[model samples]
Target: MRTSTTMPPLQALRAFEAVGRLLSFRRAGEELLITQSAVSHHIKQLEEMLGVRLFIRKAKSIELTPEGAAYLERTVEAFRIIAGATSEMRRQTARQRVRVSVLPSFAANWLVSRLADFMLKHPEIEVELEPTLRLEDFASDYADLAIRFGTGRWEGVRAEWLMNEEMSPVVSPALYDDGTRFAEPKELLLQTLLESWNPVGWELWLGEVGVDIRRARVLQLTDYNIVLQAALNGQGVAIGRMHMVRDHLAAGRLLQPFPQIVRSEKIAYWLVMPQNRRLRPGAEAFASWLKEEAASPPSPVC
Candidate 1:
């Protein structure tokens, strides 16, 4: 017996494979969008070229012969391998994109303002920003990295210190100019307290200064962004994180009424990524840029 080096036609193989899987020439033709006669013709050509009977034709149905069953198994595996290789190649091509998850307020006040420089530096990389209050799952492909505000400890991930937060009372400069002496922490209670989340920062800061806020008029908001906006509009006084409000204070849009700034030992900004996952080039580049940006002092208020 002589073996042929040349393989059979791809169209004939496809016709046979589809018919073998579906076990019906009519169904394979419907799947392949061809006529049932075309499917039968291709299978007949394939059988004649290979000198083998692949399927037993019946009046209403067809069944694979012994040779057909063995060939179908190999053909299906070959198609599966081709599909897997194609998917892997597509993923490699998309590696230039980096997805970052961050807090809404942080993204609005800090990252958005400075993101342009990073884009300028690495034009090849594309960044996708996802801002949400909920902690993202780094173990999955939800994000390439996350900038979270917390103590630098999380299970199953590597957390690197990004920046420490300092909280201070910020008021619109117009409010400060009204000559309502806010020299004392207790004085803030006289004005509406623009609060975020639990309003715990106000209580923490007041306790540190031995001031009571039991009677303070409060307007609790959903997030820090709204709180800061309320304070900027002179609606109330808000506890502003130093990193978030540095530009506003520097530009004289908002004023720190007192010199006291409180640091939270429990919460700070951190860069988190899954420890077991390797960083792709785009992720690595963004992470490095973030660290360098964090280490530098805030730009002088201009």
Candidate 2:
């Protein structure tokens, strides 16, 4: 009997797949949760094993070689099949657990509350929620489905809308109490704090209200959720995503003071998976459950 030494490492295959799909090692690193150097090293070891060039590196970007491109397509399919089969096997035993990745704010404010309903409906299947801002490669990251917010244009992935998020201005009770007059959107520029995640937000909001921002008191923030917290603490008025702020608004922690607004460019939350990937039993169950959840409220965009 002879032992074979021909099998490839899964790590190398994963690195190659991620980089080939994204066409950039830097981006692949973000998805894989590894450094760029680590990505390169994995690809290097893989190339050494196969004795072939996998990627053509340019000054600013990377392009997959013909072999790498062909390999990734098949490898991605392999992962999907494996994930699907494993989930199916677990489902037969009535002990299936699904992994769902979503943004932090959504996990805390929206999905966590609704999860109980899903569990009650499908008691056998357990859902594990992972909060992340970075999108994961389902194959490598072992996530069953990803609830992501974007324009829904990921290459090689299928996306279904979960909900549309509308935007409005929200402020703490103190801001209103301090007599900061936001009689008009323009007046907001004079006295209110423009808490921003991406700088374009204020611009977009101002454009919606037909105000050109010459200058404003701006507090640059990294996360929109943080801005929301700051607003709740009476720090400033932050632009709020309507769905996430619904509870706060209802509870009087935050108030929508004006009707003048911008429709968010941040349109929809989508459940995304690779188009070629075969969804596992858990993944399929979770997707269906999410669809049901999205439909129950009958949100216009879901």
Candidate 3:
């Protein structure tokens, strides 16, 4: 018997597949959560290992070479088969835990409160939630489903509209009492704006109400939680994702000074799953329950 050393690393294969499909190193890196230089290195390593040039790199673009095209088909099929097997195994298990990947902001602000109803209803299905900004690769046997915030146009994936999104400015009651009032759009320009992961928010809100201030002060925070916390601490007024701030506003913890709200046209929360794949036993139940839970809360977007 002889042992063979002919298998390529999974990272290299994934990089190759992403690049081959997208035809751009930068886009592939964005999808795979690697640097463009790293993707280039992986392709270079893979090409060296196989002793063949995989991409015909040009000054502005890249195209898969003959061998690369051939290899891409096999790589894609291999990932698909592995994903199918994993899905099948999950379905076979009677109580496979429901693993859901979600954005941290949405998890903290919206889902966590409603999730108890789901657990209570479906006691047999245990659930694990992974919160991160990185998009889950469904072919890697990780998450059964994911709640993604986007325009519902992920490549090679199935996305269903979960909720609409709106933006507004929110502040603490103490900030209001301290005389930093957003009575008009001009006042917003005068004060420091709190921005979470989305930096374009203040600009977008300002543009929506036709208040252009080139040098509005912004306090940037890494996550929505921090941004909201800072706003609660009277640090600054945050451009609130309405879904996240609605409860706070209702509870009088946060104040919405102005009435104007912008309904985001480009993006919303979407329930995303692997394209052409069935959910696992637990995931199937969880997915159904999630939709039911999400059905009525968000007011209709006009």
Candidate 4:
């Protein structure tokens, strides 16, 4: 007695396709992460929309009706064609050059240093790095992949998580010898310049160390890299990301003063690509390589 709508939901079509292909609504539900009844409803809705019975219900098993079999054949062929086209596109794209967008801080601190290795390995795939803080539109934009900070929920784009952010206080060795005893977090703040990327940075670090941030001397800087460099010169104590300051910290250019920790706001780097466009082989390979590199622990120098 159910009536069909002007258009059926693509979800319903997908559910029906799965059920028809598998010939088991229960199995389809398992694959789709829906209850068997939900999968059955989707197929029923599809059947109503198409005005054709898609399956013959049996006591113990389900069988695709004639109409369902025909539809399954076409859908399977469509999927195969799409897969073939995607493969061809990847092959062609891999053969050509690739462009990547990265954050200035990440590029200067991490990626650029190790880029030569990637180039040496992938001689065929040329890569160009475009540094910017602004998010570029990948649909009409020129770059193939963008490294960004966030949960990767941008509209019309696909995102893959790269790494988590870790932060701590860093200062030059000279600052420790300036007769400034940083035995306690609160005492250290009073003696050194509290360089902060944002106002909450000092507060977060203090909170992590069980110190009151309100009593700390806070100095805000828009560019964190500058603050880190300033810290290296013994100008002040800067809260720095461990990933970015790995080399500096290891080189004894910057030293941690407290046993405190600050995790990033779940907005670490991500690899983004256009939703509509299939990843060219070069882009996909580069993205994968970047993820692996980012996840790997930085060298002892870093």
Q: How many clashes (backbone N, Cα, C below 3 Å) per candidate?
A: 0, 0, 0, 2
Q: Using Cα atoms with residue i matched to residue i, what is each candidate's TM-score against the true structure?
A: 0.65, 0.64, 0.65, 0.62
Q: Give the least accurate 10-residue stretch of model 2, judged by summed lDDT.
A: 293-302
Candidate 2, residue 287: the lDDT equals 92
Runs of candidate 1 exceeding 4 Å displacement: 1-95, 153-157, 177-179, 213-215
Ranking by lDDT: 1, 3, 2, 4
Output the better candidate (2/3) by lDDT.
3
- In the predicted model 4, the residue pairs found to clash are 246-302, 247-302
RMSD of each: 6.2, 19.1, 19.8, 18.3
User: Where does model 4 exceed 4 Å of error?
Assistant: 1-95, 150-156, 191-201, 264-267, 300-302
Candidate 2 structure lDDT: 0.78
lDDT of 1 by residue, 1-302 (tens): 55454777778889999999999999999999999999989999899997999999999989999999998999899889999999998876663889999888999999999999999999878999998876766756879999988677778788889988887788898786787777678888789988777676787677788888687887889878999899999998998788999989888899888888788865589998878888888999999999999999887655
lDDT of 2 by residue, 1-302 (tens): 55236967888888888888888898999999999999999999999898999889889877888887888889899989999999888659886888887888788877899888888877888888888877767667577788887677787678888877677788888877887767777777765564545555566676778877557777877656777888888877777777788888888888888876566546678998867778887779879888878767633321
Q: Measured by TM-score, how close is model 1 to the native structure?
A: 0.65
Residue 260, model 2: Cα distance from true site in angstroms: 3.1
Error of 4 at 240 (Å): 1.9
Candidate 4 residue-wise lDDT at 35: 96
